[model samples]
Target: MRLSGRAALAVGLAGAVLAPVTPAFAAPPPVTADLRADVDRNGRVDITGTGDQTGEDTWSAGRGAVFLPNIDDDAKRCRTTGPDGKPLSDAKLAKCNDAADTTVNGAADAKDLARLRTVPMAQAPKDASGTVRVTGKGAKHARLFIKRAGGWTAVTAKTTLTAAELRAGVELGLEGTDVVRDRAVWDGSAVVELKVTAGSTTTSDKVTLHVAPLLTQHHLQRAQRMLVTEIQGKGPFSRAQQKFVKDLDTQAKKAGVKQSTVKFTKYGDIWAQDFVEPAYAGMTGEDGRPRTIRIMLRSAQPDREAGRELFEKLRGPDMGVVQVTGVKDSEEWTLNSMGNLETIPPYTHGGRSYPAGRIIMGERKDTGSKPAKAMRTLLASQGLQNPLFLDTSWLHVGHVDEFVQFLPAPGTPRGWRIGVADPDAGMKLLRDAKAAGHGKTKMFSVKGFEGMPAPKETIDQTLADKKLRADNALAAKRIKANLEVLKRETGVTDAEIVRVPALFTRGTDEGVAADRMPLLRRIGGSADTPEAVREYGQQRELGKPTGPSVMTSAYVPGAVNGVLLGPDRYLAPRQWGPVIGGKDIFTQAVTAAYRKAGFKVSYIDDYYTYHLGMGEVHCGTNTLRDTTKPWWRP
Candidate 1:
């Protein structure tokens, strides 16, 4: 049989699977008696056979060679009869000559060394001079890759072999047969590629690899997404909005951000400044029961210094709702005083007396003083130690612009309906006129003070007026104006800011005629048809039908229901104009903001009699551990 270099390499490789080559006809076969009796080693019979014994030893392993004991003093050669016994092919004769021509192990000649030199090596890449390729059955797999001199170049897997593997020559194969037809070639300085397929799966073994560029990797890891909070009417925030700000620090910490980074800013003290009542009615709790609220106070507004710090610490953790609180700072008042607030029991109302109160009554009657103290007491009762104040009074709750812009828009619940009221009488007059119809006269009554008795309205004329539609435009303006103020204060211009239009200041009695009243009044009362009343109070019918306004300045049921059920659109009503309770409003607003930002949210539902009674965290815990060094505290 003619032995191909490929086949020889394969057989050779089969012997040492680590890195093998095929077999060659140059080696003498074992089992021959001629070579066996002429035993070179003492006491050993080295029988060997010449190859190409195809017909003679077709199915047997030891057929061509045999050994027998010899009694002669000198060794003798054993010869086989030509075609009678084991016939040797010309290839076999040449192989015998080659083996006989050489020492058993370097026992003989120059011809054997020359034959070894003729073995071929697996080739590298075609275009690339240094690249080499190799393959084998159960070959030790290794991945190879290169960074091209100038730029990245994609190459096949098989073309590149490791330098170490290249140093030690390996056998190559194609479809299990030893062949050079399927090895890899180089492609210049660019990467050389090769592939080996087994079954249906192929791995990137022996690939031309490269190093990654530093510049591109750096920017990809660090890039932020701008959100804007919309303002409704009057000031930038209510007390509840402030509360959200205060709690943001805690929220950030809980979300795993560093404490110093999470922070807030005070716009104006809710206590010190006179407040504007929210433009809607609010809920009437289980009759005579005091409502619970919370807020956050801060000494400074969160800026870039704080922002960057927060950004680094926040990393990817999510912040839930922020909270705000007002801090009352007066030399005369002490934070530790137990008698600072008065507790009131739940009073009976709507034929029911409910349980309530860790009610704190303060001696100072200042509305500003009450909110701060109430907040402090609330937080303290909740076991919050070292809880620093945000800022006093002026708590405007907001967040980073990027965070808000990414938040999804608020959605309405199914079966949602609209209700309206005019905390200000402007909307009421328009509603009454619309109900009264063109050019009509009607009777109206106004409540009187003390024993003076109620004033009887003998005649009130209603003009059939198209100008009555003015209320809608005014309401829209109020919402727009409110939002504009917020936008200016926040510096968050990215989000789309759309205002709810068509609300007006309602008037008491047949008081100020819509025509006689000044064009811009924010509050008052009105006597309109109940349906008109509903329309005005809810502010839903003023324009294209929209969602109802929940809480408002007006004392109306529609507004109350809105605050409870339609949390997304409720307006926080201030109790006494300038001095108002803000904890509830701020809390809800902050919660809503967080919900918008893709956070997992749920109500704080703990037994917070003492804590909540003063208006504090019913659910959240402060996760901000002290990181300050001992020396820093002083």
Candidate 2:
């Protein structure tokens, strides 16, 4: 009869067998009496039995033993109890003199009883896959069962173990596939119980199966969903900004990908760029199973309320958010294609370790400083062997994204490649444009500020030309140095590097200059006052009274600061009709470059919303990739 629910079974036997000893007196037969058992779904077993022997019988309970051949050493034996409902001493338990003698067993073995024996079963690891192969001796004709809420449920129909296979000692595939469909049943791990019956004796063994966690970012898979914050332009959306969002939605729809728009009210909150960095830390749950998602957030920002609201909307069983204690923004963190998270060490509350599968990559610099030491300790504890460190102090905003990015390209030898912004390449394009009669292009044409006096006009024109040369030269030098560092540390070759056109400028001391100007500019004053011109030149001391400032577009908005949607798709910043290369060459060059690199480029015009704020398309957007790849393969 099949046993279901929480009910137990009890069998009573009243048979006696005679034992041979002395010939003179006849010995009473040993009695086999009632056997009561309670087996729970959680592998708890309890048994109680009684035996009676009377008149000249040298029969003792010690001579007979109860055997549980299948339980492991941890749960192999049963303790004896007295009639008073208390555990009996081993010495007192040995004397079974009366007909009413009884033997009681505990849930698990405690006395190391001689009759109880464990089966030699190959148990799987705690984090084993859904399907585990259980193999061992005496496994033939075994019945597999899974522990459920009400009681143990037999899974022989779903299992792939035949009598022949078990007899041959072949591994039996225990199926726990229902975990995917019934998540509430199995919290990442399941227990498989195998009951094997040989003749009249039955034995059981158990194994735990674990399921792998979800992958968030890595070369394992490409992003299928793009996340963008809805433009609530406190400054009012420019035509370009409006078109950018519309084009993004159009492209996403065409690619069969979903575009998730995070809503916010505040103007400063619209720059979702600095809020949270979506990452999967591969953390384990309370039951020792991998957690699905962990969203890393920045501790310091201009608008925390906006980020918090967005995080609340995004948090679910498959996703969670963790705020980093010492970091100012998520721009300090970057996840490479190899599943390695690169981050800068924060000042306070930084040192924390992560799990094994997810690698943390950090850079060590300025060991003498307290913040640097803190960062070093954090990265060291987090299990990074050799972190990639580059000097970003020269740039107004020091971030890895400003200079480097990783792209997926199956056609490449490594199946991936790195894109580095080349200021020199941008300068070369600028020089070519100037040579082709584009030098006279008006640099800045604000409505109220047009048609200035002779000295201002000359100074503006000179400063614009000089700023381009100085900024490009400094940026190129820095890029060269950084490239060397990257090559030495990561072993990435120049052939695998895609040089994208980009430029940088410094922020002024007073923070007024939108773009930096060169130190030298000959301002021609009125021809009447030579003395006035000399005094003006002395007061200026070349051009800048203060220092250099943040990066601004000379000809177009940040072209290289585009988003890589997938292997074949890219979203580049549209030029907004900027006169570069003697024509509107920003769109033409950027599009051609991406297309040449085997990407279908989609131009996004974020000139007014993001570019005016010294950021680009990528700064305003993010992507949550598909985690279909099996992490075990990596």
Candidate 3:
């Protein structure tokens, strides 16, 4: 009976009809259909057999004073169509505003008013949360009301208003973009400003609003299981094996996980694609939704020419290179230098070449054309407009010196000294020992010290006594010259060359060679064992486990967690131990390069295994919208 936000009403005045009451104390007399029909054309169709107060109005008002629906000349032009789609002769559509298009029957008579009443009013849902913050310029002139118990309550009476008042206080122009409600969005639209007022002043607070779901999120728990097997790492799988792997991946897709094919180049062909499948752009995943996978290729050598070439090629159409003229050669050289390289000479170990540098290339996959454009086409290729040289260093081939530059901005000094303390606790022990000076520590007697002052077994001593530096320098010079030939042969620049650092430890055909005690361990088990080799193959099909492993040295920056600059580092897959190990070197270096390029980086080790290598961290995590949730839950 109350006047809600909607513009329709229900009228049943039987009580007033039964008793003759005064006009002020009684309800307004119900108009009769016959009288209404005389004054109005539109009439209520009693299809539901509802009562029609045609001539029941007991009170007869002054004939001249009585008012009727304004059935004007323009209103007469409009008519209501019947079920047969033909206009009714007795009724015509009402014309409230326009003379064309939208037309409703005029409520000239009680029957017409009854017809008007038959036009259903817009009612709120049974349970509706009616208040919503307005967004964008659409908030201007926007008026909404609170709905409670299936009825709209006008919190602001006469809810419609001008743009200024509609904004609630602030001025908002209505010419900008319209507001849209995006359910999947992390942050809602940026329109209404949020502020906290204190006394006469107001301070702007965080204005971004996170869209909360109307329903609870579904969570699932996962279990871990170990798998073991042995098989040759190579080639096109049997149809049966492929089907089996496909089934497993299908299951993984349903479980919201990913599968990857890891191929160790050392075990077979170097040219084998890591993972291959039909384009996923049009593929529907297990959840009956489109599947999206982002492939991030990272290698140890940031300056790997081949890798860079491939990356550039993948970047597609926008393959034009950026050249800064008059830029200092040192800066240019630093920027283009191959990222990861060997720290020591005789770079070859175990009949494999340790890349003097590392380079990695990759692409991010998506179901849309945007990611494809960034990864496959030439649109918005480079994320960082002008990448600054973060740091550079070399190994035994040269001096272990490094240079690092920080972004020039407020509160950040242009440059600062960076140190490389061994994460392996070696540097900590040395510092502790130095702090607790000489006399406090017991020393072994010189008499029992082997070789009195120095051990003859030291590789350093042996190399020095043999004039190894000069011989090694000449050998390195020859290797460099040979590299020049290889470079010419490959047409790859020295800056693109990748080098691998030697591993101090090696793993035997048994377990990790019984002597190595590296704090960090790469996930891939050694290929030396037949069992390990088989397990590696099975893992390729089953997918790698999400786990962490040991890593050699990591670069450290004050503000950045992933990037680092130290004496020297290198990566290689073929060459094992004290030189080059497996492919992780490439992955880690590539991850680091991205960090230096201004992208946030996170490391997840042992995500999966293929052939004899482990999957990278980036391969496991997927980033959605950049809406950040507060870490601390209240």
Q: What value does the lDDT take at residue 214 in candidate 3?
A: 12
Stretches > 4 Å off in candidate 1: 1-634
- Write out the backbone clash pairs for model 2: 77-109, 506-548, 506-549, 506-550, 507-548, 507-549, 507-550, 508-549
Tens-digit lDDT track of model 2 for 1-634: 3322222222212134323224434333321111111111111122222221111022111121111111112221223456787755423332221111111122221121111112222332222122222343212212233333333334443543333323322222222111111223223333334454333444444443332222225432455666665543322342334456667777766655665544433333434444545544332222333223333332233224445543335543334333323433332222111111333211111242211123223221222111122233333332222244565434433345566666666665445556777777666655666666766654332221112321223212533677656876777776687777755544557876777776555545432124322111111232322231122111112233222343323234566566667667877777653355355554566667666667787776665455544456776666666543323322
What would the C-alpha RMSD of candidate 3 be, to one decimal place? 26.7
Q: How high is the lDDT of residue 339 in model 3?
A: 20
Candidate 2: where is the Cα deviation over 4 Å? Answer: 1-220, 233-235, 238-243, 259-268, 281-291, 294-303, 326-387, 443-464, 510-513, 516-555, 576-583
Highest lDDT scorer: 2
Clash count, one per candidate: 109, 8, 54
Task: Provide the TM-score for each candidate, comma-separated.
Answer: 0.18, 0.53, 0.20
Q: In candidate 2, how many Å is residue 496 off?
A: 0.8
The reply for model 3, stretches above 4 Å from the true place, is 1-207, 210-258, 262-391, 394-462, 465-634
lDDT of candidate 2 vs native? 0.40
For residues 346-443, could you state the per-residue lDDT of candidate 3 as single tens digits?
11223333221111111111111011111111111211011111111111101011111111111212111122222222222223333545222221
